[model samples]
Target: MSTEEFDPSRWDGRDLPYIPGEFSDPDGVALHDDYDADIDPVTYEVVRHSLWNINREAGETIQNLAVSPIALITRDFQTGILTESAEFVFFGQYLQYFSGTMDIFTKWIMENRAEDPGIEPGDMFLHNDPTVGTPHQPDVALVAPVFHEEKVFAWVSNLIHQNDVGGTVPGSFCPNAVDTYWDPPSIPPIKIVEGGEISTEKEDLYRRQSRTPQNLSMDLRAGIAANERAKGRIEELIEKYGATTVKGVMRRLNDSGQESIKETLSKIPDGTWRERAYQERSMTGDDGVYPLELTLTKEGDELTFSNEGTSEQAGAINQPFAAWRGTILSAANVLLQPEQMGATGGLVRQLNFRPEPRTITAPDHTAAVSPSGIYSNQVSLSMANSVISKMMLSSQDEEIRNGAMTPTSAQWQCHIGDGFTDDGEYFLAPMTNCMMGSTGATPKRDGRFANGHMWIPEARGPNTEEYEQSWPILYLYVKEHGDTGGAGERRGGNGGKICYTMHGGEMELGVYTTDAIPKTPGLFGGYPGSRGETVVLQDSDVKDRFAAGELPTDITEIDGENVETVGKGPAIELDDDGITEWWWAGCSGYGDPAHRDPELVATDVRQGGVTVETAESVYGVVLTDDGDVDGEATESRREALFEQRLDEATTVDDIVAGDEAVEAGGGD
Candidate 1:
């Protein structure tokens, strides 16, 4: 698509930045920003920490109140507190990306809907429109304005991934989506709960598009309850400390976060860092590999990001501008200013996003964004993590460099089961075991194994027993897939693998994923980790073996013909006789594997985390039969590997000289 063919500004707040002011469309709503109270140091600390705790508790409220697997079990929900104008002040410990997107969603509400709908007291707005602001359509948000003396004092918001919103497929993730229209309905901010009461009509309207209406309906109440619970706490604090005093504390927290980040950035040298990643295949029945690149430029105390060289938005592998920027914000929060926890509003003030409007990283509203959360947006997460880590690594200050790490585990794989339960109830939910992704290797330590996703580090998906009860399948094994982490001075975390088969009911499994090939890059000289793929073993003997009282742990042990190996595209379904199995490698490494201590490699071999062949070829470590390091042999192998690498590589000096000579021969 051409840049001239698309205009992002026409579709609801698609291109607006969050700037504090009265509503342009609605003027009657009052904003209480009177920060005149003189709060003592002790009082300020008390109120500041109290607000943070409130946000944290609100997130837990969602977990307790909702029955959706993504909510109660997967814990994919996030809650946050924003200023009356929608600038994030405190974010809970959940999906870090939601904090950024919610800020955008609420600011859009203040800008556009405050008049017709009226942002009155007791009103709460719900939304999941990627154009208006959300990572994807499945993540629905509820925002309530905390009114103090009938003025908007603050806003409390929460969003959880619903089980199903109406789409061509179950789980609302259409990997084969033709466009955003083919995916779930994108609802902009609407009054889901009005005047402190559940609007039954609006709630019906909200869940009308979902395949699993009961699940989405309950999730609706979960979000509303979370926001109201948080709102009550905010009101109590305002009553106890006085609105002016509490507002002053919140302002100070923002100021502290801003100054802290500024000080950290000032310590680092000004420089630019760039990283590139690729996503294979756009939709089902297509074989296309597209590149996405991110460049970070830091000058003085501010940082700027650009996606200048990304490919044009295509198929399901595209994200809206809000999601693209949200990935950046999540990275900044974790790597740059983690000590200031959820103060992304302050962090964003020092950051600017300059995006090319037509690219996958900043697509127009017409692109299929539902799958972007699992695919392309994650590519953005990996790139931003790498560039920021590199930039932070350049700092002379040890404290600044302490925060640096390689690219995080940004890859994912999943199978959504759409089938009838043995008891006659129908179901549509993900296996969700894919949440146990590995973390990237850091400079001084190995990445933690099965640490879940990089975006929401806190989420550990439901247990195996829960999966069996919820779906019509039985898990053969859900174990760590060893030897998948990239080889380096410190190995990356290990990815997870699982095998399963049909048990008692009719079933159809929808496979949704991105591949492990052209893998997410490793930092320094470390090799990239393997990307994962999903495979179906059709008409397998695994079930027959189960009848014989023997279970299989290895995919190789299953005697079956491979039906199809799927990547990032349309999902393929399967019947009861077929078996499904898949695995993902850990995030990439942090340094040269050859530079690693030989003993460490041997230890990894002993633990089954590294294969003996990999130890020799990749790490140049020779291990004895007893899994001990063969020091003399290791020394010889390391020298040979180093020499072999030099022989296989082209010299940079030679290339640079050739370029110079070509420039000198301008006449020719």
Candidate 2:
């Protein structure tokens, strides 16, 4: 395919089933194609199992070896196994976006570096440049090539989120960054390892850009070690099954995955679904709110996502193209084709992205994408989940409709702080309590309470003890935040709230976040999730109470000076004595709230998942003094609520309601 004939709009969805890109050059990928050999069913299945386990084990290798708290606690890293041509065969289930970038940028490296330095055996490359298709700068990837008989045979890569890289602020969210110049240096793929040896010159150059050089060194080792493990396993399998059979298995897995998705698409009706989300204040002192939209169209057996209504590249909340594509791919893999086992070459092959290259969802090289991990990526994921779920819900197949998932991780918030401990030790870290975000509602039932993140299925927050062991911060409480989810018959999951004060240190804490507008959308007539808030109490005497042997849990009772933070803000010095209270809301609900069951409402009230006041007002439920649901009062209250809605409603001619809706085929 020539550059003149190739069109991004009419992209072939089949390349993902094997190679993620077309073979514009080196169609053989520098060696002969042994994958064309006829493979027996037994050998293919065995090798397929081996390939999947290889990637999963690679992730375990990183998790066990990485010293980064983000990797150990939140498990916010990913690993992948690619073909000799950098086509992904199996990617870890941690962060789908990481694999998405790994696919794109590794191909970029192959296209650009094949001749100069060459793709050699026992060599590994490091990449995390947004301009070259990385989602963000902190998400560093290690890509290594495997050789069979002096020819490129396979590649193993892993990406992990670092706590901090050199930038305007700690944790590298960089809210003050107006452009890439102010961001952590975006490094493209470079040979970080040569002949199985760490390149000291390259390692020093990379480590010098991070605030926590020690941590960076350890994580780099972890990435290299993960690739080494995967490489070893691939070699062992090749030796056992023969390279031709192993390569045949990689080829066949993508073929089956692609066929599976196409079959599913053949059943569902084709249509377009649109979802919109908002983010307020790009940075501190910026009051403008921005709009981001996703238009997902299922045409025949293919899907195309377009960001037609999103805002232009501006401020610091913009993201690269890979983030948008990754969010969609994650949803399609989990909800549409979980059976594929992350052999997403086929799932991605069935999808296309009509990216708005200069928009917030697909910003250009000049944009500040450092904050994307917390801002732009979340909006894209939430909107993608919404649009994709709507498409599946409208399908005639019940299985497809039920496969629709609500938001897993609606948005990301970073409660990052850096300061000096009493012993004069420097500390920079993020309180991952926010990783316990709200899960979205499902068609079958309500969403889970702080279940997990959208993109990361295994996403979990660290234990309170873990933070205490690592830093001088004391958590007042990390508890369920009630009434934070949307109200409906099947309510959205509840979110979590964390309140903590500096104990034995002086810190500069900053809340770099999003969801000034709820990212997850409620389905049917369900209500949207509540917005998030970050508050700090200044000049507090909470320490005095702690000294008195009184452990305070309620933040409102131990208040001093309450300072609220805007969603977007510039770099600044915050009060050291302030206790940060973070409230991240939950996913959106499914169905109408007033029609919810009184027994469920009563149960929620008793369990602290919902307050009694909210049950009565939002759900129109009545409860007795003993906490039992009052059935007669609830019925009467529901009746009154129906009448009140009629009284307050304005007249409409085209709107369908009551028996008219039933006659118009609108009633369920």
Candidate 3:
């Protein structure tokens, strides 16, 4: 039983394993299954539903998809049809898993394509060049190619956000970067692997330019391992089903996605919805204000997401055409059937975009598109947010609401390498921070708090004890910053914190950040969440230090008071009082808070999400000390404030619905 022996076409076409109303085609026979064959008329009659969860999931995976866009089609080769299934993340965002998985595959494919092109079917490749396969350098991909009967069938790929790929800065994402050559280590799509073996020489070339070679190598290795796993699983699927059935299913899967898109297009009013907006970069690159304009033309069963109006930025903020398409398609899926699998290729036919190079969204070959030093993800999110705002005007989807939301993004990093301690023993230090921002208000709910990086999943639990015993670092404080969440139906969740002290031999640290000032905006009437910051400590005082600096030879945490900021000698505090606070920009609010439920307000207060003062000041909702809602007071106040506008008053049940929906929508 060799790994490549599976074929999907040999299955006896009896009733395949079905999930009733759910879609499942593991064996590839479903390629011929009529679209209406498993139909449940009652379940199919629904006209309105939230596709937020699915769309968000797709967003999470889009980066990974772009890293290995070509490899995503392999599921069809193995299963006899391309089933729109992707890996999942703890936060339920599909893009994260998709990107991670695809990253691994891209590397595998690049290594295998030339050497074991036939028998070694599950091999992949890794590269980051526009001419060969990918568009830019920061977006490195891991790809794997699938084969049937020694014939190449399909592929899988994943992408990761590398802060630096050579270049002038510690992180390669320099906003000031003008040309591709200015960006360091711009890897063209050359095979860094051969016959499943990674080229150490090539890897060394990458490490020479990267600030954190150990971290880069570790992450890259992880990606390769992930793709190997995908190859193993996909081959198993083919072995269980037969190649013909798998191929048929793969083709049918594309058909199904296209059909789903068509159905969604038909439901919307047959008119074009247009929106114009600009996306600003946090770090000013060679150019200023990388204006990203979006023009969405929804005509009947066809929709086009174009970035013709966008202006190119200095560096990696510029996205490739395929990557841009992935993001636009991801946003569109939110407005359509989010729960369905959005496979690559034909499923994206209905959605198209203009590929004018030199624009921020679709830059020319000479443009620097690395994301390490620049705020690339932020740029993409801003453009997507603009489109969402426009779509909400014609639809009831509050996810598109930009008024209540504030725009912000955060930067966090960890260092893991063979660092020596006092006794010269090897150690690894992983530092993670909560780079948070505001969120928009949903239809019936309040805005979410301190969420940064539309793509970052939750950080693993803080390793305080691990730091104390294994490494020479002090974990001073780790908690959520109070009053940081934005105001809305419920105030947004607060951002988490981290304070550490360095010791032993001098160690090098890397910090990646962006959206430093203007926060990522919120939707509806919800206010944006808090902004994020990173600093160092000498004594009890906070010190303004650059990321490329070295740490002291010894250090320790004095008290458990959880000092918010650290520095040398004098203890420096973050003066949130107007000056410093205003320095950190918050996104705008979404809808009106008066429309939120009083009960929900009470719960938020109990959970420490909203303070009594903010409740009174922002949402105009009052509560009792026992966390009970003052219904009479609430009703009268809401009525007076909203001028008897019923749409502004969300009931207790609605509040519950909104909260539940947020959890279901998949962000922590």
Q: For each candidate in the order shown, give its overall lDDT on alpha carbons.
A: 0.79, 0.79, 0.44
**Candidate 2: global Cα-lDDT?**
0.79
Count backbone overlaps in model 1.
2
Tens-digit per-residue lDDT, 1-668, candidate 2: 11222254322111111113464445223753576469888878888988899999998988899998988789989999988766679878898777777777777777767786787888899977876766789998889888898888888888889877778878888878888888899887899998999999999999988889999999999999999999999999989988888988888787788899899888888777888787777865788888888888788888888898789988888887876777777777778888788898767667777765578877777789898888788778888888888888888888988888665445676677788788999888687787776777777878877667767866688898888878878888989888878888889888888888777767776544534666668888777877677777888878788789988888878868876567765433445566777777777888888978789899999999999999988899999999999989999988898899888887544476645543212222
Model 3 TM-score, all chains together: 0.63
lDDT of 3 at 557: 22
TM-score of 1: 0.94
State the TM-score for model 2: 0.93
Q: Candidate 1: deviation at residue 118, Å? A: 0.5
Give the alpha carbon lDDT tens digit for every residue of 392-495 in model 1.
88889887776777677566566776878778888886767877767877777887667776678679866889888877788888887777787788778878
Candidate 1: residue 75 Cα off by (Å) = 0.9
Q: How would the candidate models be sorted by lDDT, starting from the highest? A: 1, 2, 3
Model 1, residue 363: C-alpha shift (Å):
1.1
Q: Pairs clashing in candidate 1?
A: 516-531, 516-532
